[model samples]
Target: MNLYVRSANGYRVASVDEVVSAAKRAINRKYRRGQAFTSPKVVEDYLRVKLSYEDNEKFVALWLDGRHRLIAYEELFQGTIDGTSVYPRVVVQKAIAHNAAAVIVAHPHPSGVAEPSAADENITRRLKQALELVDIRLLDHIVVGKQCVSLAARGLL
Candidate 1:
């Protein structure tokens, strides 16, 4: 489903999914002009808007090719309001399967606090290590809520 603007042509309402799809396309276009994934803020904005309406904890991975072109945005895990169990092995496997050169993983907090818990920190560390073994860089683990927290910026990764 997609939402259309009130244009001179017509009127239409798009579903949240459709809006997100459109947003993704626009964002990709902006970055693909020889700037792929160079701005962390852009990625965070995408994640924030993509997961904004989600009420549950949804773990998403943005898989990127060698040149940092976004290959896919995959929601790999879902859990309750508080937490989700993310398997480093499974994440690594998906990265390998996608032949991704790098990945940015994120999870939204339904409570709207973007703070990274100790578990979040630990998982980031583990995932960094896991991906390192395969030569796939774990670019960042973002905690999304009212805002996005980049563990990498915090030196957590």
Candidate 2:
């Protein structure tokens, strides 16, 4: 399927093909540079482009192993805007199911502000603690918008 993005800036058509292309470009750039992704926006951008063709509200989590490297990235949930929910227990369960050693969670702010809200902070703290109990590190909680913020880099996680 093809994806479309509409904003005050304008409308643009993005297909799954384009998304994969963009992600590959991003990954190659990072790999060539020998650096880890430093921002959540980068990851979000990859997912957004990759999933742009789909029609649903989705949240994705990127699971990492002990070395802070990507083990897997998957969509954790999907629903309409008014009533989507995320449970910490489910998150922990998924992490355990994946045998993830660490995690960097991310969700998009369609409104385009990367600021972490009080609720967002609280959730991150709760998830971090939960994961810690199982020896799975919460490496970061990233808020993606037109920009992105890393709670770990900001010392919030």
Candidate 3:
């Protein structure tokens, strides 16, 4: 059965089977269309269902190349209701390990506010700067909630 956590913003739906099915369906759709997806909302929707069982906040980063092709996606960290601990060194290392040319980062807000928090801004800035040293570019940092926000589009990164 699906479980849900009701918050002031909306319901946090949790069901591993449901999330996996959704993600597989999305992946299939993309494969069938022969297109690469760069939309943060689509990615976040897939991840939310995947991570619904975890009560804490979770962050996911998708590493891409210069051609805007996806290399890999990593769940950087998880934290309580307030925040998550992100290590710049680790993030940099992961980018290099994947040989990524660009990156798109995302995190879920349990409160359902897609706006980046002060800490989110700080972390994004730090990651961008760190990745730059390795010649990797940060394409976007997205905050996912009931909706989504893109830091790159907002000129925050």
Candidate 4:
């Protein structure tokens, strides 16, 4: 399927990839380094743009500064349709490399539900402990799907 947008050109057509790419670029530009990372709405918008159409499981991390400003966003792991393995060691390594003071991690479910699994909670616990050793805060773990859920908001963190 394709999309058509009416502009000065009567009808301008765009592919899904083009639209998504444009959206991503717009998002990056709108949410620069100085933008606050404290809003759930903002985080959800960013995560949706990053993982909305993924079919396989993906793990991503957002490195933030002391004031929760964005430092880096990267995909750390990609897994099969059902699951991904996230290593705290690798997450800590990258956070240290980025000189991050805090982190927000997220993953999307191909199954279209944002509920955190037992495994998700377990990883969050392990990650929190690992990051604590280096003094980096684990701000939240967001599970994205048809809806986005924050483990922190649920008192899981």
Best by lDDT: 4
- Candidate 4: tens digits of C-alpha lDDT, residues 1-157: 6677768969878878878888899998988776887788889999998888789999999999999999888899999999999999999999999999999999999899989999999999999999999999999999999889999999989
Sort all candidates by TM-score, best to worst: 4, 1, 3, 2
List candidate 1 stretches off by more than 4 Å: 1-35
Ranking by lDDT: 4, 1, 3, 2
Q: Model 3, range 40-148, lDDT digits (tens) per residue?
A: 5565555555443445788777777777676776788888986889998998998899888888888877787777888889998999899999999988887766676
lDDT of 3 at 152: 84
Residue 115 miss distance in model 3 (angstroms)? 1.8
Of 3 and 4, which scores higher on TM-score?
Answer: 4
Tell me how candidate 1 scores on lDDT: 0.86
lDDT of 2 by residue, 57-136 (tens): 45567777665566677788775632246678989999999888877776666556668777678888998998889999
Clash number for candidate 4: 0
**Cα shift from native, residue 92, model 4 (Å):** 0.6
Question: Where does candidate 3 stray beyond 4 Å?
Answer: 1-25, 28-35, 38-54
Flag regions of model 4 displaced more than 4 Å: 1-12
Candidate that would win on TM-score: 4
Task: Locate the minimum summed-lDDT window of 10 residues in model 2.
Answer: 28-37
List model 1 lDDT by residue over 1-157, tens digit each. 4457665778867666777777777866665433567689888888887776678997889999888878888899999889999999999999999889999999999999999999999999999999999999998999899899999999987
Q: Candidate 1 at residue 59, lDDT?
A: 87
